[model samples]
Target: MTTPVQLYVYDLSNGLAKRLSLSLTGKQIDGIWHTSVVVFGREIFYGQGILETRPGQSHHGKPLHMIDIGETAIDEDTFNEYLAEISQHYTADKYHLLDFNCNSFTNDVIGFLTGGSIPSWIKDLPSDFLSTPFGAALRPTIDNMFRRPIPGAAPTPATLQPSPAATQAAVNASPNPALAASLLQAVASQAFSPSASVNGTGSSAPAPATQPQTSSSTSTVSAPVHICTNPSSFHSLLRSHRAVIAMFTSATCGPCRMIEPVFEDLAWSKTHGVGKDRVAFVKIDMGVGLGSQVASEFSVRVTPTFLFLLDEQKTYEFKGADSSELRSQTDLLLFQAFPPHPHTKLSFPAVEALSSEPILFTQVPALDSVISKLASFVDGSSSPSETVAAKEKLSQSFPVYLKARFPANKGAQPPKNLSANPQLIASWAEATRTIASVLPAAQLFPLVDLWRLSLLDQPIATWCSAATSQTNPVHIFMSKAIDALHTADMSARNTVLVTLRLLANATSNTALVRSLLSAAGHRAETTKVLVSSLLHADASVRTAAASLAFNVAAYLQKGRMDRLRGDSSAAGMEVEEDGDWEVELVSAVLEALSNETHSEEVGTSFRAAA
Candidate 1:
C-alpha cells in the first residue's frame, strides 16, 4: 500500500510574524515558513543535517498547515536513502535563513515525493520578504545567524592522495584496531590537506608524529609523518607494519639524492593511502647521528642500499639506486603479499572477453520530443489532479535541471564529478512513477529512455542499485515492460527494448549487479524476464534481452572467479551450493540458442553467455 505524503508547514516566528509582517516589511507575510515532509509515520526536516521526529513533535511545534501533497509509491527505506544522499548538501554549515533555509528543503522533498512543488505562497515567501525594504536590510543579519566555521572546508587537489577510496576501504576492512586507527589518521590527514606529505623524506629525519598537526587549530594544512631517526622508532614501525622497506643512504651520495624523490613518492602513494597499515617506507641517513646506528645494525656497506622486510625478516636486499628495479620489486612484493583471486587464471575466452562496461543508452534526443510525449500522457481531461500537478512541475523543472547537469556542448552525458543533488533526481523518479502508473505500455519508452541516460551518473546509479525492488526505478519499469509482454502487444516492443538496455546499464555498478543476480527474488524476476523476452516476436527485444543476458552471465562468471580465487569481498559471497540460479540461467540460454533464428548479435551474446 502507498503511503500518504503530507507537508507539515510550521511558522518559526509563532503568531508574531503574521501579526508584525505588515508593519516591519510593508507586505503581509503569513509566517517565517519552516516545513517538513510527513511520511512513513515520521516528520523529516533538515536543520543540522537531516533530522526526524514523530509528526508534530519537533521543536517548531505543531504545523499550521498539514497539506495533503500526494501519496508516494516509494517505501521508507528508499525515502530514507534519498534523504541521506541529499543530506550531504544540507549540513549544519550549509543552512541559511533567507537562502537555502527550511522552506527550500521542503520544496525539494515535496518534489521528490509527489513530483509537485510546495504551495506557491510558501515557496515565494522568502523571495517576497527579501524584495521588501525592511526585509532587505535584515539579510546580512540573517546570513550571519547561520554562518559558522567548518574544519577542513577547503577543497584539496585530488592528485595528492593515491586513491582515497582504496585507502578508506582498506581501513574499514582491517581487522586490527590499532592498524585501523593508524590508517584512519592517514585518511583524516588526506581529507584536510591532501597535498601535505605524511612522512618526512629529509636526509636527517626525526621520529614520525603519532598524529598530524597543522600550524593553527583551524588550518587546512597538516604536517607530514617524519621518517624514523632512531633505531627504537625504526623497530617500532617494523613491528607495527606487515611489510617495511628501509632505505639506507648518506647525504654525500649523489645516487641517494637522485632516488630520494622516488622513495618519497612511493611512501605517500603506497603507505599513506592505498595500502593502509600493510606497508611502510623508512629512510635513514648514515651521515646523521642515529642513522649510523640503524645502518650498522642492518649491515649496510654502501650508500643507497635497500632492504625489503616482511614480518620483520629481510625478504629481499638490493644495492645502488635503480628506480625501475625498486618499483618492480615493490610491486612484486605487494602482489605476493596481497594476491588476486586464482580463478582469474581460468579463462573461458568468449565470456571472459565480454566488455564489463554497463550497456548504457546515452543517445541524446531533443528535449522537446520527450516533453511532448509526456504532455500527451498528462494533457488528457481524465488525468488525475495529482498527475496533472506533477506533470506541470516536472515539465517546467526537469528539462532545465537536465540541461544544466548535461550542457549542450557535453552531449547530454552525465558530467564529471556530478554535484550531489538528490532532490532533482528524486523528483524525476517520482514524476516517472506518477506517469508510469497511468501511461500505456507503448508510451513508457521516452520516459524510460531519459532514466536510462541519467543512470550513467554514479550517484543516481548507486541510489537505484541500493534501492529495494519495489522502489528501484529500473526494476519497477522493467517489470512493467515484462507485464506488457504477457499481452503480446507488439506496439510495446520499443518500451521493452529500452527497458532491457536500462537493465544492462544499471548493472554497470557492482552493487546493482549483486542485487540483480544474487538476490533470489530479483534473480528470479530478471531470469524470467530475459527467458521470456528471448522468445519475443520482435528481434530488437530478443537482441536487447540477449545483451542483458550476457551481462548477467558475465557478472556470475566474475563472481565465480572471485569465489574460486578466495576473495571474501566478491559480490557473489554466497556458497556454491546456491548454484540454482546458474543452472537456471544456463538452461534459459540453451533454450534461446535452440530457437534463435534472426539477429547474429543474439547468437554472439549466446556464445558469450555459454
Candidate 2:
C-alpha cells in the first residue's frame, strides 16, 4: 500500500508558509526524495517532506498513507525532539536533519530536510554572522548545519547593520553635497588681489574713495580685502574675473619646469594693465593624487597644457615643451584676454613712416640718351629700310632693368641655387607677365617663352605650392598668363589650358575661384573651352566641371553681376535664347532673389535692372 506525504514549507521574508504533497511506495524508498525546512530569527518555523513513488493503485484502495508526518504546529522543543528521532531512526545516513544556519554538512541531508525546492532569499546571508570583536558568536551546531545547500530553505532577510569598515567605504564612495556646497561658497566669498605685496612692487596704487562719507554712512564704509589662498578659491576668483591664463602642468614635467619662471614674470607684469583686477593667473600642479583625479576629469593627457580661457565658455589650448614657445603663447593669450578696442584700427608705425619718405628719381644716363636718340629718329620722315634700321639700333641699345626687391631676410640665408628659389622665379614671372600686358607684343612673346620653358619640367604639385605661397603673388601672374594665352597661337593656348586644368584639380589650390574670375573676361575663349570640356567622357572630369560651374556661377552672381550688366551684347540678348552659362548664372540670381522675396516691387525692379 502507498500513501501521500504532506510537506510544509515556510518563507520568512514574506511571512508566508505553504504545504505540498507527493506519493511514495515501498519500492521507491531507495531513490532520492527532496523537501524543505524554513528558519527565521534563529528558529525553525516549518518543515517540508518529499517522496518518490511508482505508478499504481493500492490493492486495498483505502487511500493509503505513503508517508505521514504529524501536524507541523510543533514548537521549537518538540520540533528538535522530532528531528533527533528522525535522525537516529535513519542512521544519520538514510534520513537527515538539515539546518541552513549550520557551518558544515552534506547536500543530500540538506535536500531531505528542506523540500525539493530552494527559496530565493537564502543567497544574501552574511558570510560571518556573529564573529564580532564584541564577543558575539553564532551557535556552533547551527553553524555546522547551515554549511550545506538546503534544497528549499528561504534566505535570511538582510537586516544587519553595516560593519565599521563597510560604512567607511560607503562614505568615501559617495560625494557629500553639504561639503561641496560649503566649499563652493567659501571659495566664492574670498577675493583674489594682485596688489604690490602679492605680485611684487608696482607703480599704481589702489584707488581711493571718491564719495563723501556722512555720520550715518560710516557703517557702510569698505573694509580690508582678503585674498583666497587655496586652488579652489583661486579658480572661483578666475571665474569671477573672466581671466584667460590657465596653466595646467605637473611638477616633474621638464617643459613646465622651464616655463614656470616666465609665467611668474608675466603674472607680475599683469598688475600694471588697466584691467589688472580682471586678469588672473592660475597654475595647477598635476602631481598629487587629487590633481591626477582632476587631470583625468579634464582629459589632460599632456603636461604644460596652457589653456587661454577667453571667457567662461571658450578656451584655446597650447601644448609644448619650449620656454620660448610658452612666451609666444602667452603673448597670444594676452591679446585674447585684452582685445584691441572695437573702434581702434591697427597701424604699423614703420610703414606709416615710410609713407612720408621723400621720393627720389634717379637719372639713368643710358635711358636718357636712348630716349633722345629715339626722339630724333622719329622727328624725320625716312624710307622703310632707314626707319627699320633706326628702330633696330634703338632696340639693341635699350637697357633691360631687372630691379628686384627681395623680402627682408627673416634670419635665414636665401637659397643660392636658382632651382631652389621658387619664390624668386614666381615673383619674376609675375613682374614679367604684368609688364607684358602694356608692352609691345613682340617684347611680350619672348618673356612668355622664357617663363614657359622655366616652368616646363616642374611638377604640378611644385607649381601649385609656388602659386599658393603667402609671400608670392602667383595668382596675379597666372591671371596675366591666362589672358596672354587666350590671344596667343593654338600651341600657347593649349599649354595654358593644361596648366590651368592641373591647378583646378589640385587639392592644395583653394584660390581657383578667384583665379578663374580674374581670367573670366580677358580669357573668354579659354572660359568657353573650359565650359565645353565639362561635357567630356571621363566621369571624374565631368564631376569636377559640374562643381566648378556651380562655384563659378555663384561667385559671378555675387561679385561680377554689375560687370555682366555692363556688357552691351548681353543686354540685347533675349532671356530664352541665353546660353547654358547665362542660364546657370541667371538661375543663381533667381535663387538669391527668392531669399529677398519680401522687398517691395520697386526694389525688386531695381535689383532686376542691376
Q: What is the TM-score of candidate 2?
A: 0.21
Cα lDDT over the full model 2: 0.33
Backbone clashes for every candidate come to 2, 23
Which lDDT values do the candidates have, in the order given?
Answer: 0.62, 0.33
- lDDT per residue as tens, model 1, 528-589: 67878888888788788878887776666665555444443442222223567677778888
TM-score: which candidate is best?
1
For model 2, give the 10-residue run with minimal summed lDDT.
Answer: 19-28
lDDT of 2 by residue, 1-610 (tens): 2222232222221111111000000011111112222321121111111111111111111121122222223355543443433221121111112222111111122222322212212211221111110001112322222222332221121211223343332122112213322322221111011111111232333322122111221111011111221233334444556565666765357666566666656665553343444555655555531344445555767888766665664366667756676667766666666665553365757433322111111221334454444344344434254444544443342222211111134454434421323333444544443343344332233333323223322331233221322222233334544454446543344334333333333222212223233321113433543444343333333333333343444334433332222222122111112266566444544443344434354233223322
RMSD of 1: 20.8
Q: Mark the 10 consecutive residues where model 1 has the least summed lDDT.
A: 215-224
